[model samples]
Target: MEFSVSDLAVARGGLCVLEGVSFTLAPGAALILRGPNGIGKTTLLRTLAGLQPALAGRIGLPPEAMAYAAHADGLKATLTVTENLRFWAAIYGTGGVEAAITRMNLAALRDRMAANLSAGQKRRLGLARLLVSGRPVWMLDEPTVSLDAASVALFAEVVRGHLAAGGSALMATHIDLGLAEAQVLDLTPFRAKGQGQATARGFDEAFA
Candidate 1:
């Protein structure tokens, strides 16, 4: 499946931060979103994931086709690593938590509750969710946060496998995944004018 965004405008704190952004991800491809901090990367990913509305323009994919990973782990703190993967796998109807656990190197930590896991462990488990997501287009926000070098390499391999299997991804990250095939999209050109000027009364949320 192809994932695409065109002439997109997005807001954060009720103010437009990015506009006129456009890109397309073909099947088996990936795109990395890059810019200085506070450049609206989160807002843009949130908008693309339909967690927040886009201020304007178009995104070409159904909600079911995309799985989004936020900056946070989004884990069930009370659930064990295996349990967490099972929960998400059940939701996505993939029923393949074992593969995800092994893929993310969570097999050793599978029985540990999310709250007991270290930051990097939690991050690996979080990325593991995407394996069972069964969605072709991944919209990830800083997916490598909290990971050590080895874990990051593990993640890069997982992503590479996904693309090889004909999946696509859009990610916001500072770390280089050593993915030579992944293209970079700098959001600097799309920074909205008067972006920091938040209004006391702003336009209603826009979705598309």
Candidate 2:
């Protein structure tokens, strides 16, 4: 499968954040987004995931082909790890909870409650849902936030396995994910110019 973005523009709170962004990823490839904080990495990812509308351009992929993992873990604090996986599996109409658990190294913690797990473990559980999603494209935003060195390596292994199986990934992270062949997109140059300058137009007038 191939995923493409062309002349994309994203806005937050009705204010433009990024523009003129474009890229493409075929199966078995990965693209990493790099930029300083508030440069619209997360917004761009959200737009690509279809969580929000793009102000301009087109995305050449079916909405179902992409799965987004934002900064939030989205876990049910009251649910056990296994329960959480099963819940998402059923929602996505896919199964293989055992394989996902093993892939994410959550087998031992499968029965543990989400609220009781460490930050890294919880993040692992959150990422494990991606496998059950059965989507070809992964849109991740700072996916390694709470992971330690070992867990980071584990996550990389999981991503490698996905790519090997003909999946594509688009990730935004400040830390190195250890993917040697991944392409990088820096959003700094794409930031909307003169955004913070005082403009003659009011918010209501602009949106009107």
Name model 1 segments beyond 4 Å from true: 199-208
Candidate 1 positional error at 152, Å:
0.4
Question: How well does each candidate superpose onto the true structure, as a TM-score?
Answer: 0.94, 0.92
Q: Tell how far residue 109 is off in model 1, in angstroms.
A: 1.3
Residue 128 in candidate 1, Cα distance off native in Å: 0.4
- List the global CA lDDT of all models: 0.89, 0.87
Error of 2 at 170 (Å): 0.2
lDDT of 1 by residue, 1-208 (tens): 8777899988877788898999989999999999999888988888888887777899999999999999788799999999999999889988778988899998889899999999999999999999999999988898998999999999999999999999998999999999877999999999999767874447444421
Q: How many residue pairs clash in model 1?
A: 0
Against the hidden true structure, what lDDT does model 1 obtain?
0.89
Model 2 ranges with Cα > 4 A deviation: 197-208
- lDDT of candidate 1 at residue 109, scale 0 to 100: 90
Candidate 2 C-alpha lDDT tens digits along 1-208:
8998899977766677778998889899999999888788888888888777787889998988989999889899999999999999998999989999999899889899999999999999999999999999999999999999988999999999899999999999877877876999889888987676432322221211
